[model samples]
Target: MADIISLGIDTGGTYTDAVIFSDARGVIAKAKSLTTRHDLSEGIAGAADAALAAAQIDSREIRLVSLSTTLATNALVEGQGQRVALVMIGFGEDDLARDGLGEAARAGPVIFLPGGHDVHGRETPLEMERLQVALPQLAQEVSAFAVAGYFAVRNPAHEQRVRDLILRDAGLPVTCSHELSSRLGGPRRALTTLLNARLVGMIGRLVGACEAYLSSRNIAAPLMVVRGDGALISASEARLRPIETILSGPAASLAGAQFLTGLDNAVVSDIGGTTTDVAILENGRPKLDPDGAMVGGHRTMVEAVAMRTFGLGGDSEVRVDLAGLIARIELGPRRVLPLSLIGHRFSDIVIPALEKQVGSVHAQRNEGLFAIRTGLPDSMAAGLSAQEASLYARITDQPQPLTQLLTTAPQKSALDRLAARGLAHISGITPSDALHVLGRQGQWNAAAARLGLDLAARQKGGNGKPIAADAEDLANRIVQRLTRQSSHAILEACLTDDGETGIDPAKSRAIARALDRQPGVVRFSLALDRPLIGLGASAPVYYPAIAEELAAPAVIPDHADVANAIGAVAGQIRETVTVFVTSPEEGIFLLNGSGETLRFVSETEALEAARARAIEHARALAARNGLAEPHIELMEDADAAEIEGKRKLVEARVRAVASGRPRVAN
Candidate 1:
């Protein structure tokens, strides 16, 4: 196992990283390529080929291949995914109003049915006539379906029946809420299943493409995917429940940071093109969010790392705020194509447009902005409204100035809709462009970056002056803003995780003064209790300043840029199952959970049965996930209350965890 080679890949918002790894020698070689929005396989193959060539390793030498991806997270955040119909069994329309489920449910139509289970695993008479009539029409309209039944976790009979019916009649992928989690929250579980359904086709396509690429190269290896908890699962399992991988890339980076720095306690901040994820490590392990992973503003029931994902990163959209006397520089909750990289790839079109914009005397609206087609296939463009279709048809391969492309407010909105659907992209100045202008990062088109900055600097401020004296000054301001925001994000995550109260990092004036190191009569200072471990391609360039502001030491490990890929390869397979032993009545114990139900007269017998059942299910899952020589650990959480001078058992949760490395090539 130590000698076997592992191939690791991570698909991120800006780049796809690939690495060749050996447990004995550590990271052997790593490569990064621009992530292609239109087609992901091209980027994956490019990085893999480069890494393999650098390592001088043949495809046959690799025994394992693992991947981490941000596509699912990005889709949920940006409202991009395949259309999926939600079939809510035993849930009402009012259920959608909770947990931001209604807003998230707008991806497709939601259908309600009358069939559910009681907390004790009792079934409600299921009525499927409405579903039967609608399945065929839904199959044509949606790419997948999500079904959630009340109390389905206690007994998944209703969910299973609906799943079987959909698979048989509609022939479409169906995600059942009980299959995603055993928790009892119907609406939140439905939200998770709804999201999982939407991501199924997208993730399945990505996994299929990777498998095909590996097969073509004769890389015969078991493929695995990094889960949001930083554990590994078979690729097939990942494709079925990709919502669990919402924080996959960030979770992998946590493992990579721990492995690279050997740190037991540190704050891990992994910055990527689209977002900066912040989390803390204690005892060399990241904590799981008990409330479940919250992505795209929806609190889901999928178990994941307690990571605070802030929409502040390299390619974050840069805009100027003129509401105040001093125009403020702001970064994003929205990501756009960086001007530098777009110019690097399409210089002929980008450079001339930018040049013309910079050559103008007066500062104009959207002078530094451009829109380009992502080149997605026409099938993805299906069901586009007339306004969106018209706007999209006008967008070509060549980057067009936003001022020219969007003449009216409605057209501007239409372009936004098109971008949201992944059919188009908007390019503008970003921190990456700022880096290029400052000569700190030279991977892209620096001249175009300068031109874009110059055009932006020409904007008249609220003070009736140019925003900056020159492009270089404006670039400095942008970088400083990013550093300030990054430090705040890290501090916020630390404070929240440490269970502190009242002091919000973003809004606290005292905290701001401390970070800014301002001179004041009432002086304040802040520092982290632990060092900051920064992991990402840009960590070396940006994290030192962030660490300095927080008064913490910076640990930027070697190959930090490819840490996500390294984490994917270094992770082990792990599966967990939980069973419940509840006393619904006196003198009787009812056992249920994880899709199983049983009855017992004695509490001792029922508790023991729950333990064995959990262990059995956990091991079965581990085996199915390719874990060899698996080790099982059990945890007992018993609940009791004093009642009438006697201690009565209320409930007991038996949890079993199975873990081991993936099986090597036979």
Candidate 2:
């Protein structure tokens, strides 16, 4: 039997891609299957089955399996997450609705109490009786809970106390904001915790499914999920903080793009069936957007590659202005054409059956018998009648011209007849109205099929239909315009602070408005001299072409279709823990923990304490990350200032390093 191999799978919007890698065979095999969003496990199982079969390996020979998913991200974006509750130990009701925190709180219930800590490690006093009363009152309704405090990062004791209280009384999963982030901003930190809470159940189930799948395949190795930053962490850790995986898809693509292009700097355009994504990479690293990015409609602060999305793709609904005579805009690949054009090319059920039953519209002599009907305007009908004799004379000699005439002047009633054809000639409905319905909410496949027939009956060609040259130009223009606008919005968001003046919104808006210049100035353009590469099936169709047209060398990589899965395959385990502290006496700060008194007499001591804490955190994470006998290091900082009689302060930083056993050859 072949040596055991690692399996990686990524579930995307349209497809689930799986890859197998073996030391002996190098890259063993890769497989793709349609994604079943209704039940992701179906798509995963199908992809896995295909990949294993392609590699010619028995399920028992598989050593490990890992998955990179966009499920959690999707759930958050589509507002399909569980109803969660936010518990604040010492925060006001208003805190839950502050800045980034407001976005997460919007997902569920929020409860605030009087118990908390001051800037120093001292307690701010709590209404314990009220908390006890509230815990049971709030517990039954929420599936998950998030607990955050004003200075939880500096002193998590109060937060931990609140968590214990909630856990004992509510029996619900709880995430403390301080544990998730060491950042100073309370609202952002709280938001991060709330997001983690909301995704807890979804991620847990997803990870559980993967685990079961792996065990069934006899895979013994541990599993790891890639974070939004393109780094890896243990499945257990990922389950706790699923928000980190929100941007893993794009990050992985950027990573894969970096690997493929071998360039230090460039811009990448990744276009998929649903949307087009553009990002800039410098020194082989995608820039991380610290401020929250909007996914679907909500904002999340997950580490993600900064990218601009355009609602334009091969499957985009092409809009046409049938309403106006002067300004008719032809929209879309909105009409996803049926494969019946070649006439019974395949045995694909409906489309094939439809073509056989109705015959070709181009071949029919009777206008009413034709499958492709036309909805002609009064003006166009007049023109057609004036040229009727000439058109009829040329029909046998120049059928192509006759067809062109019908394209320009379609009859309205014929459209209704065409819609009734059903399985005869129009099976795949591709209409702008149908596309709008599909894009909005529910499945409109049936409606789409009907609309496709109606569209076929409409005038095929008009002044609204642009030539191929004009289409290419238009695609490029749309890409440029959307990219500039989204990027400018992000830049403007990044610049705004509590009070400090930054990027002027009006100026940014002006820049976004004038998007006509090809290769125009982006608020944040990459060094394209080095080339930016894109990954994903649609990246080639949308990104690379746009980049090239913009005078930038762009590369859309092979296997870009499954780069996210590849990222899952090539990641390492990681973890992080953050503890907070507050000031006590003048020039003295105290750590709020369970153990010994970690007091900082000066700023140096406070900084040292933070470093030591960070190192300890990394070591613990290393163990969870499957690192045996993990080594560690520390780095830290303290923010302190004099106020009245005492110096108030806070401490923070990170300590991280790699630690893992070498893989043994079989």
Candidate 3:
């Protein structure tokens, strides 16, 4: 059987990790490389090559390959993705107001057509003529399209029709709401579909890159992708519904934590470049969020581990809060290219720029900031506006000081938009740079970090004094702020799990007093109920301070850095399908599932049909996901009421799940 070795890969915001593992021998070898945002294939191939070389294994010996990534999660948190247009069928402007769809849609164009369906799976008059007139123009304005119709879950005919039109005419990727979730909330479903449409191009490219690299290496293995719930799915399935991968990396980390530590109950916190993901482990399993996975304040309908993702990480942008006298330091919600990294790549420009800023009498607002081209193809920049295109043109492959690039305040906004679209990257001081300055880390150019910090330290506080006396002092302040924010993020996740209401650890005075250990008339202290399992490449550098703040012990496993990669291959293939049977009228049952609706005169017949359809769909999905034979489980939730001593059926939901080990080559 050639030992049935499996290869796992995780492409995170800052790094790509690869691991070779076997069921009998465990992890054989692992390697990491800096993630290449411009072209992810470079990072993936680098990591894979290193891991294979370390293991001394031939590429042909690998039986299976699996992957997990934080790209979708990072994009959502940073509000970065391809520009997409939303097609709303039979939805009013008011519909966009619901579920924050208006905010999520951003400046993307929206086309509302007079076509949809009712709850009874009856179609309203569809205006295909109106759609025909608008789609041609809309296609030129965005990279992809999202089709969400009223009551799409009950009947997806309208959504499907629109999708077919967009795909056939414009040849652009289209996401239909019903294809994502069967839930009834039209606006929220539309929002999810819209987000999914935006991610298709990105995830598709990632998969294509992996497949291409594997093919070139002659590693003929079925490529699988880790889902948000730590299950494996075929790459093709992942491409169609990339939104399901929002927490893919975090979920894999949770599984990895449990496998590495053998802990049944603990709070697992995994820190990456752009986000820190926190989740609770109970009974050797992660808890699933019933309300759906909420990331970046958007409640998505994707099934995933109950994880709280905070935009605090090593590569987080270091911002100074000059509103207060002390000029408090705050770590990111937005990731920037670290100065240390930029210095390593372009030291000639970075070091000189920082030295000039530090030598100046007064530090400017954009003193230590720089921008560079992301190296994405010009095709990805197709939908840029005039201002965005102009700003993007000014940014070259070489780093340019933001101070030199932006002439006016409005130009700054234009540059930000360019960065948000993944067309450009802004380089600034980050915690990773702080670590370099303090001699805690030396992976990159420390001289550049020190220079950047010197400029940062010269900034005036509210008291009209320097924020810090020296570069080292500023570095310490930044590290301390990161620890504090990390503690708050962990506390908030715990409090939310404990069902605490209206109490945000970040803003709570009582929690602050406890964390700061401030003595008063009445002393207060807070501690986690369970131990903290910190997983990341920099966990050892930052987690001890975070653990101290929370009064909890921190456990860092030996393989924590590559946990996501390890977990990617240690997962099973799982597929779920939910079918709904609703009583639309007296003695009439309507069954809806898998984009099909059927009517039955008897309730018994409809329920049976729903269950059969759910099971068939689940098994098919499992098969498509590379599972040869799956074990099936069926669950039913029936809602009925007794009215006038007679049983009346409201709704019945039948759910079927198929799960099995991923098929591997012999």
Candidate 4:
């Protein structure tokens, strides 16, 4: 409606990036800011202000703003969602475990009831009085409600009735499972609905804040969000289907990669401050995994660009193992030394202060000094008395002798994970902990990690053996072992997802073991020939070798560090709707919405309808995003089944330019 110059923003774990584009100006400007985990809006505003400055234009010149962020994904991973109640119209306790719903529903209470409908739309008798009794208590505790019933898509009456009751009593936002996922499988559907409800309030606030920021700056652009599948959607639609934006960051990287390489099909990898993400693109579009994927830690059935994430990044922790067979491993991408430690080492300030306070020059005896100067945690500092603190300081200054210290602290945790199959222990602490130790999330952690590594190298191993003769090598190994496990797990998961039947357990383990070794891009390239494209913040550091390994040119564009932001800005609005058409009689397949029945015939007419539907859906999404004169691209696939007749699935994509032309400056 307004002149449609659009601004796109992408907020990652460590940075917030913004890009402003005008058709008239081509590309206006872009800006970046450090992401503030505490209050995300601060980072958003910072990025916006920077972008405005870069464009050298008043905020009023901006028309529409689109944003994609990791805020919701972070909330879920950090276990920080609002309280929610699961209102199941028909489910038993056994249903949770059977459908794999129990895992994601760990946060909320799953309430089962007596009402449900059959596949043919007939209602199962329900106990209204019992349900009424449970409603009040649930209403008091929960900020939101998620309603799911067996076969709700076939007969939503039971779910609707429950929704009506919840609206009257709970006075909270509610998400019907049927609305979120049109597929069968009650438990999976319920999980999706519950997740949607949990994130609704948080996402709403984030969007509202962004909108207000733009309004305050007089940027009147229509807001849009990049979906997880690398397609764009209106802000309102994204809010409704926030799950689709779970991997929005990675999707943006792929989009940016495609734009950079101008190659439709290739493997794209982005290495960032904390992780490296690898994904594949087909036909210039990021591939989508049909089964929902995991983000942070929870699993959700949202369409996202398929990717593998590794925690190996710049800020990982370095450690040594002594209780075990004399090895050292880094504890984190999350933990690190602060730059202040380096500054401290170059001066007598930190060590002298430690010696003065503790009344000891002995590194071990200077525990208080170690805590204050090196930013070690109380628990860790307390592990060392004043004498140990002095020793720690000596090692922090020249840590080649403290390998013994690193080795001793983590043996029990590693053994428990390996010997007891309790990976829970090995899951390292987050970067947040390291930040807290340093008194700042970013700068301090970096300094501490560097300082800690230098000190750790001086220690002995479990066998009373010296660590690697090379401190750098030892430091690198420790970091790799700690951060690479997640990468190992994700790659294994992808292999399993490739529809391999009855995978040999030994082969799976072998593959994981190889990946754990952190093969360079060359090794990975030999294994898989797909071209590798790097996208995350870490990409610059890792892509050259990765490109070499893949034996294909790797493209890292000007905005490579903020590839996701570019993707978020560059994507076109799109949507997808899947409808299954079938007939019980088995000869002809009838589409429910259109009442069009196709007899046993050639592929032409069936193909046309399927493509048309896909186009129609895509066009509608374009329209919603203010795209005028939308164009549709259709794709159709049909399968023959023994149980049901010929089934056709249609996928459509639509695109259009916004109605308003870009404004001319000067």
* Candidate 1 deviant stretches above 4 angstroms: 361-364, 641-648
Q: Which of candidates 1 and 4 reaches a greater TM-score?
A: 1
* Winner by TM-score: 3
What does candidate 2's lDDT look like per residue over 1-666, in tens digits? Answer: 566478878766456788887646645788887565334566778888898899898776666566777655544443445567787777776665666577657646677777665555556776667768777766656677888887665567777787888788888888888666655677767777887887787677667767776777666777777677677777888787787777666666676566556666776655444344556677767776665555544455565666544443333333434454432333222222222221122234333343433455443322212232212111212112334423333322111211233443443233322222110121232222232333422232333233233333342334554322332333343344334433333333333322334655436544334333425355433223445465665454445444543345656677777766766666555444444455555666665432333776765676567657656767767777666565454444556676697756644443445455322223
* Cα shift from native, residue 598, model 1 (Å): 2.8
TM-score of each: 0.95, 0.68, 0.98, 0.70
The 10 consecutive residues of candidate 1 with the worst lDDT sum are 375-384
Candidate achieving the largest lDDT: 3
CA lDDT of each prediction against the hidden true structure: 0.88, 0.55, 0.90, 0.56
Candidate 4 ranges beyond 4 A from true positions: 1-4, 22-28, 74-80, 126-128, 273-275, 294-299, 309-323, 328-446, 452-461, 464-474, 478-527, 545-554, 578-666
How high a TM-score does candidate 3 get? 0.98
Give candidate 1's total backbone clashes. 0
How big is the positional error of residue 113 in model 3, measured in Å on the Cα after superposition?
1.5
Judging by lDDT, tell me the better candidate of 2 and 3.
Answer: 3
Q: How far is candidate 1 from the true structure (C-alpha RMSD, Å)?
A: 2.0
Can you tell me which runs of candidate 2 are displaced by over 4 Å?
A: 1-4, 23-26, 128-140, 273-277, 290-530, 576-583, 586-589, 592-597, 600-612, 629-631, 638-666
Kindly give the number of clashing pairs for every candidate.
Answer: 0, 20, 0, 69
Model 2 residue 611 lDDT score: 59
